[model samples]
Target: MTRPQHFGWFLARGFGPQGWGYPSLDWDYDWTRPEVYQEAARTLEQAGFDLVIIEDSPSLGSPETIDLRVRHAFGGPKHDPLLLAPYLFQATRHLGVVPTVNPAASLPYTSARQFATLHHLSGHRLGLNVVTDTGSARHFSDAPQLGHDEAYDRAEEWLDGIRSLWHSWDDGALVADRATDVYADGSRLRPVAHRGRHYAFDGPLNALPFTDGEPAIVSPGGSGRGLGFAGANSDVQLALAPLHEKSVRDYRARVHEAAVAKGRRPEDITILFAIQPVITSSSEEADRIVAASARPDDAALQQIARKQSSDLETDLTALDLDRPLDLSIFGAHVSRGSIQRLIGDRGEDAPLRAHLTALARAGRLSDRTGFVGTADEFADLVEELGDWGNDGVLLWGDFHPVTLHRTLDELVPILRRRGLLRREYADGGLQANLRSF
Candidate 1:
């Protein structure tokens, strides 16, 4: 309970219409070039953001599907975020670095050791976004099939083994008691023998006690089984519902309530939602950007969004505004909670074409569907989303570095003017910055 902070938020870009996503899925990636991404990371940290997260997927969609497109792997030869985030720590000073890792790629023992080292190397500024890849097992070089919830079932053992290893190096355990000549107290470190339904691991990870300020866990479980697992252990309960402040608020409150029922403090977990922000000098300019994005010929919204449509004949941009929406043409199966959210509001009698177009419109234009407007209005949404229960919102941009700079150059100043966001950082490390609240 170090941070009594009323609000907390982080910025990130992955799965946007831009590089990390579209190109990863085998589209053009002119927006997210290497230098642009580096600059984007630099700018977000410089803007005094609490943290910036980078994510990964060994195989985006299901790797086993006969169709290569089914895996939905974004970007060609995508880099590893686990390896990428750590490299940024020394380059940028304060921004908390979190990387999403596919646990199935590396066992818990190895993952824990690496992250524990990251916590130490980064001055306790490391964070984790845990995603159990049950579906990815089929892609592995040497692993049997693990079902959906089955992956999460193994996560319990993974976490238990990982936590024990982190705690193995207890307080003052590594002291150089000169006269005592004790490098570490042998009695303090304990072995964790974990034999669970899905996994079995003996002893501790090959890492010293992360000592202090180990990476905080961000639990985001989208399914029913995942929820209970996440609710129990996450420092931040991360999830994205439809783009409604009310739903965002209610969902977060439910997560907090779930933690309370588990005999844990509600404030122990923070709710953070995904928000795509497009900022401009005025509302008109922002609107134009949204309009263009909503109609981007290259967006591939119907396909890129994991939507259930293929072989779309017409250019969605040519759609006339007067037509009714038909929701049936789009097949019943689509991924992400967002699809369900959009479909819930569909009219039964609506034309499938119109409904599909609107859904396409919503996905194509990042700013159009998100909190968009002038700096002031954008700030208002940030505050409102916060008031609704999210400690903070994750920012996704259409263009990598340019859009990030806009936030620093325009929106951040406005937020500072309103006395909402901090202009200067508080002294202390990650814990100190958060504890100041």
Candidate 2:
């Protein structure tokens, strides 16, 4: 028997050009306008998705790599996702809108007040996709640049300060006495004075107290420190790992262990693994697609290089494909994990062509592991994960109507039939929707 699972959409490109690289760009919806995303949000709500997480990165990389970042519109020219959340809220009532926010870019007091206002306006449908990106610190004045672990430390302090401000108002702070014409009891507000290594602030937040609950905390970090942070503070963990049953169980156990260490129940946090399934029309078509990718030609290799270049902030297309890639070509700031992902299990002496060809190879759905499949095959994978005690799966793509429909159109009804997807949402905003199952 399959159990109902939570679903979400990851706006993988941030607020950048939607449909730019895809054929859907011909649809001609202005990426700067909100209508495209609004339509997408409504579609997600109708499909019973619980939330939409908008990805953001404030910087385009150093001057040397700016060309690689934006040449394909892969990384730069992004508007603020936080500014776009309200439009999504105005468009849908139950689906949560989580915009990526970095502590290094904004002060604690400002984040608390702004988030509090959106939380109220959205009726507690706001969520924060907290990120501790150290690369963009230079964009903010007087922001300190820290190492990886240190960055998480600063984020911890920043979140602590924000929570303190959110809780500054006491239980009786809002005593609206009708006869006395008093709107609030100022005496009941508690002052927040936070002095931490990364931040210093004082606030009895001017924003009103939350009637339902504070905005849900969503985090995407797989590191030890990242998992620890999720265990301690997050309500949703954006997870990524191999989709095998044992792998899923092991990963959930690690997260549960971390939560238990922090005195939190395992059920307190929803672990939604990130998956991007390639939906095909038929098994034969899926087989053809997988077969076509087995031997990538030079053109296919170049396209792969372009994407990898944007991600690593290094121009890989210019490198000699016949020679072993010089790992030192990557800058000091490039994430080690990104480099490892590009290399995979390939040997250190392997040529660049070998790496790109391995990446271009596709797997079949009959294997019950890889993502290339028809809707029914995809449903089989979802049901198998449910049997493994999976919490949910976050489908990744651009926040465009075409992308939403392309992925969910056939897959949705199939999952619904298997009792793997929700048909209706319960009230109480994002948290309630998450806890409904």
User: TM-score of every model?
Assistant: 0.78, 0.97
**Distance from true position, residue 304, model 1, in Å?**
5.6
- Give the alpha-carbon lDDT of every model: 0.58, 0.90
Q: Write the per-residue lDDT of candidate 1 for residues 1-437, one digit (tens) a residue.
A: 11112233343334223434433424344533344455656676666676666655455443223243333333223456666665567666776777776666776677788888888788787888777755456576566766656666677667766787777666766777889777777676667776666556665556666534557777666667766776777766667777576777678767877778778877777666666655667777766655765663434544533334211211223333335434443332222343354445665455444455554553212243555577787777666665565566566543355456655578777776665565555554454444434
Model 1, poorest ten-residue lDDT window? 1-10
TM-score of 1: 0.78
